[model samples]
Target: MNGADVIDIARDAVYTLLIVSGPTMAIGLGVGLLIALFQALTQIQEMTLTFVPKIIAIFLALVLFMPMMGAQMGDLMARLMDRVATGG
Candidate 1:
């Protein structure tokens, strides 16, 4: 493939990655912010307090978003495969 083709493929890959991971990342961010707020209010500066809740929230997000993620990934894979098949 040419440089342009390589760049396009890379862009698509990154976009796909972001789309697939966005939900979990957003959930983690929201959870972290809430935990930080709680700590600020309670004056409890426990580092591990952030980890468990963030992990649980992210895990739940992942589970909830799994079907959407799978569809996005499958679409990307199909596109990539089609490009490869056509020697794009």
Candidate 2:
């Protein structure tokens, strides 16, 4: 593969990565923010408080989005394999 092909493959990989990770990351961010707000309001400075909810929310999000994530990853893999097959 030449420079352009390499760039295209890299771009596609990054795009797919972002698409796969965006939802779970957003959920985690939302949960963390909410927890932060709660801590701020209550003055309950418990370090572990944020970890549990964020982890749970992210885990649930992964479960809920697993199919879509798989589809995206499969598509990316197919594209990469196609490129390899074509000697690119």
Best by TM-score: 2
Lowest-sum lDDT 10-residue window in model 1 = 54-63
Clashing pairs in 1: none
* Model 1 bad stretches (over 4 Å): none
Q: Write the per-residue lDDT of candidate 2 for residues 1-88, one digit (tens) a residue.
A: 6899989999999999999999999999999999999999999999999998998899999999999999999999999999899897
TM-score of 1: 0.95
Clashing pairs in 2: none
Residue 13 C-alpha lDDT in model 1: 92
User: Per-residue lDDT tens digits of candidate 1, residues 2-25?
Assistant: 999999989999999999998889
Task: For model 1, give the RMSD to the true fold.
Answer: 0.8
- Candidate 2 wrong stretches, greater than 4 Å: none
- In model 2, which range of ten residues has the least summed lDDT? 79-88
Estimate the TM-score of every prediction.
0.95, 0.95
